[model samples]
Target: MMNIKETIIFAPETFNLAETTRSIEVAKECSHVFHCIFMGYSKKYSYLIEESNFTFIHLEPHLSDKQITQIMNVDQMNGIKHPFTYEHIKERVQNEKRLIKIYQPVSIVIGTTLSMFISSRVCNTPLVYIKPLAYTRPYFEEGYLPSPFTSMNLLAATIKKLFISIALRITYKPKSFTKVAKEENVSLPKYTIDALDADYNLITTTPEISQVYNLPDHYQYIGPVYAKLDVPIPKFFDHLPTDQPIIYFAMGSSGSPNIIVKLLHILSELKVTVVCPMKRMIKSQLHKLSFNENIILCDFLPAHKISKFIDLSIIHGGEGTVQTACLTGKPFLGFGLQQEQRVNINQCVRFGNALSFRKKDFTKARMEQLINHALSTRTIKEKALEIQQVLKDINGPENAAKFLIKHFTVT
Candidate 1:
């Protein structure tokens, strides 16, 4: 048996800890597992990973005075044609190498929006790219951004694309485009590895049905690996009227507090019971709303457990949250903010299991209207059940482990 050393790196704030947990479970079967993370190092995650017998490394960059000044300069010159130079790329590449050497792992696993794209080129190590949650297709079709490029003729669209491409090359050098260009020009250093040539790219989605990007042979859809938690219902959940349906509302970790307040107010006007995860910034705001016996507030609740009792969920469309909602067979009313959330909302809508609203479109009246429409719809409910059945049929984390063992183990 070949003993392997593996490192999985990701940002701490992302809601993909369940996926990381799954990865660790698989890694332990044949190798030693190490975790690399940034920011958000909570006791919950630390305790969880410790129980799995994995080592954790935290990287929090403390910028020097000179480096801070340089970063400020880069920020100010946002419009500069060449914002990121060879020097910038070199600095990042060196930093990554230093971090990896501390662990001395045989292979690395990366999650987050662009970590794979950056690390694969910088560290020159074998890597696996985990897909973050996103909308598949139908959501995008309904959610349109006001685009000058799309409105103009084909010539204008082409011109804008060319201009944006050049601007991106200048600002985010050593990005996917520049990496490919550098390889072709023989400028990529010997230490740099092309992610396009990676051994495998594992996506946490069903590619057979997802509409975003085609699944290449190198890319495998491994389904959702969300962490499951058992949440004890507080006294509040039990007292709420069991006759009427419950609505779950959360703005995720970084969502705007104002939005949460607006949602609470809208829910109070309706007959449905509203459950919100108490956030500090919005606590006072929530207090101002007249409490109908229907409002329930708590600091934190296990979303999966709560979804079982709730008929609908209003969320920021975080991948983990959305997947949990799907597992419980509950339809969602997604309020998407970031690009990734938009993608998740899109997928939910495509699956016919959710509806989405952009942050800008969320008004008290609009929210009430949307919620009422969803409550009246039987199709969404049916779809939710179908997706729930699909989730039940798959052994998500186990299957993902099997794939990793097959491809990553060195003979």
Candidate 2:
């Protein structure tokens, strides 16, 4: 019931809402000028989809958790497997092929530049990659202001890069990638990183967080894209002390529930006031747990809204949450739950505005130490102010939307 000529296909390859949120903001921002048809697996973020302002196409072949676990079992890193396999890509292609028949789009939007690339190529549509992270690796060149994110010397950084490169080389079989190419009836470059080659690379981090590096002209660095909601402040927040800075805390969905519970209990005794937002299940069980009035529990309130009112944020190092914290020039304690998160939080620490901890090594004492450390120092806030101005000058959604419209305008 929509014009195929005006619609843009936005297909998120992965299931993580953290990454999907970037495209959501961009689409909502520009949905007036251009119609965006969201195409993907639905069960990933069914909660927010109903409330979101966009049309969605549920791809064929629903995947149960058990099926997802089996097909995606090989070469698990950080003890977590990626969301794709030879079989998953085949299903995605079939679904996309069906979508093209119903509504031919002007162009296709992508994140992580994975399985969808094959379909875009077949349709002869321009593909736009919207990355929530910086493509630039932290360079520890001699005499340069060492980026603490890596905590490595030039040699160490190089070695780490090589090691990771090797890991990527062996992570999947050549036949797995080639099989997708065969399905598309096209030849794809051998390397996995080649997937990044696109009509445009819309990088979504400020240059302040990324190391200065020469990139292809197609790569444009837009600042962080954050979604805003108009929700009323909870009455519980008003009861907390306005006298001093209150801690904004979120453990994220990645942590073990038991570990999360233990950590929350230990953090409850802090002398300073804290605001923690988490799942309803945890909030329901809080009656059995003990916490002072100083620590307040909340359920899925808008983090951006709550961000402005808080002095410091403690997060699980997801891109969207970290970006939200930075936009406000607020200091934070980042507890990275996985490799991707560890890298993200490491950059924040290296940027000199935040603290980073690995979930494996992060203990209650370390959490207390970092919280006190971030609050006590004015330098953290000062450093955050440095990036805050840069982010403010950069309009993430508008710039990205305009660029896409221009590219597909002539189509």
Candidate 3:
């Protein structure tokens, strides 16, 4: 087998530590040169680089933005692209080219939106899209269609309009940054179609639960790559109360803190264990909130381990988090923080495995109602359990590793 140098470019702050670390570990097994890029701050994922398990090279993150907030809001799919934002695109394009030249990367794996767009514009690098950065499904996939003309019925049309509106965000660029590429160089993709133009599109979701259909030959649905957290169990879980229902909740990076705090208060009062893994920034605010013995807070907790005790989960509609909920045989209530989450929520609800709510539609009573519904509903629980078996049987990480290795071996 011939081993070539491979550079894995991840979007800063979006790609979690476990997925990146495991991919690096797997790539090393085949003797590929593994290089990574990260920027800003990631207290949760930074430990992978600091604690060495292999020879992974650290590369600079692409920080080319005309305005920091503008780029973030745009990159986050919360903002529209500025027609006059030529300099910013050029810098990003130049930065990507520079990194490609420096590392001499053969295969580029993207896990976020901006990186996906960057890879689309890259000249020769083969892109391996790991997960959905946008809510694009296979063209023939059955369910709510995004196109205005395709909706055959009134309900379908209504849903299509709703999802489409949510997909388009009005982002504001807060501050500008240093330019790495020239103003005259790069042109950004205007649509999801242009952004996803890659050599390989690897989906981590299973076909059984997905609305996506008619995948092309280059695309692969390998199942869920659930994060493997080494963090110890929280002390609250030391004693088990099997009688009452328990729920694991995460607001994710994009979730609103005020909403989470409000929900926590309600969950605490419901006489059930609410296991919430919070980011450190939210740690202080949690002190102000009241909690009963059933409310447990931690900096980190393994979802797989913790899900054993949880009856349901509440998440900000991330794919990885959804996979965790599904693979653990627990239903997750998707509280969408962004537009893309609505895509996942639609699919999960369509398949009858999970419940969902848009943030705008959220109220304390609605949240409580959804929680109670998921817990009491047996059909969804059964479907969740069934999906769990399918996900386990698929062995997402191993199969994904194999797929990555095969690309290296063949080419």
Candidate 4:
């Protein structure tokens, strides 16, 4: 067998450290390793990758508005060539090819939306995709689906799933069918198709629970990659009343400002010391609020670590966020928007570890109501502990790394 040259790993700016860590682990096993990130490097991330002996290349051009918009649009379209003509495709291919050449990787692994789009277009190297993990099956099984198109049945419940599938298929033509084939010096298929035809499709999910999908032979479920960052707990947490059960309210990155404010208000009225991590979105607004002694406005804190202290978590159901909460065994009050998030929220609800309120349902009254309900429900707590034990039993990251090494045979 021919020994592989350097393998290039491409990820978006928003790619979490856990995913990055997993990628680096897989890359280290290969002969030589290189990386291309869409955004500039953080010292922490740079140090980690360097420690693994991989050459890091932060491709700044890929982070530009023009590039981001182009990539987002391509994903929104699902890889289909609409709006963008063949001429536009050619232009983009030419532009991206310059960066692709610099890395000179034998195989490329794409883990973020932007990187997925670019690699689909310009690189002829073998491709692998690492998707976020799926929620455990118990979560999906417990959700209530209303019946009939208009009735309160499971059929009604599946409508959201149906529309999401249609929307995704319509917008982003599968990269495999459109870009990958074209770049491989092969004929491009007429429409967007599944990503299975790639050299490998390593989904960040457990095989025991993934829903039915047309996955090809290359597909493998590698379980969740939970990233952790160290953060100091505020002195205030030590002073909070020990008797009162703590409830954490955080709407991960990209959460709506109005919702954050509403949650804060409700928590204050409830007299709960809610910890809200304000990222770039609502950081300024977080300062304006006159927080009661019960509310903690945190700019940056490691949520997984905090989960060990809190009784319940109110979140905007991102996969990574939910997985961390679950691993810690805290029940969730999920508020989700996008299709994937909704699915995760539904899964949490099914497992009896959570209850969800869609973004449309996020009103001050509803927030208060959900918080009250969550606090009152003993079953939710019991279920949370159950799932926590299950997650604890699984060696997620190490198992994922072992799978990649076994399948890819880096040595």
**Every candidate's lDDT:** 0.57, 0.67, 0.60, 0.57
Candidate 2 achieves a global lDDT of 0.67
lDDT of 2 by residue, 293-349 (tens): 777777666777665678888887777778878876888888766555666676778
Encode model 4's per-residue lDDT on 221-288: one tens digit a residue. Answer: 65665555445776666676777768777765435577788667767876466777754447667567
Question: How does candidate 4 fare on TM-score?
Answer: 0.73
Candidate 1 deviant stretches above 4 angstroms: 1-53, 62-95, 113-123, 133-199, 208-214, 230-235, 278-293
- Candidate 2 ranges beyond 4 A from true positions: 1-5, 65-76, 80-85, 133-161, 164-175, 243-245, 252-256, 280-293
lDDT tens digits, residue span 301-349, model 3: 7777776777888887777777778877888788765555666665677
Q: Work out the TM-score per prediction.
A: 0.69, 0.84, 0.77, 0.73
**TM-score ranking, best first:** 2, 3, 4, 1
Residue-level error in angstroms, candidate 1, position 99: 3.5
Highest lDDT among the candidates is held by which one? 2
Worst 10 residues of 4 by lDDT: 135-144
Candidates 3 and 4: which is better by TM-score?
3
Kindly indicate the candidate among 1 and 3 with the higher TM-score. 3
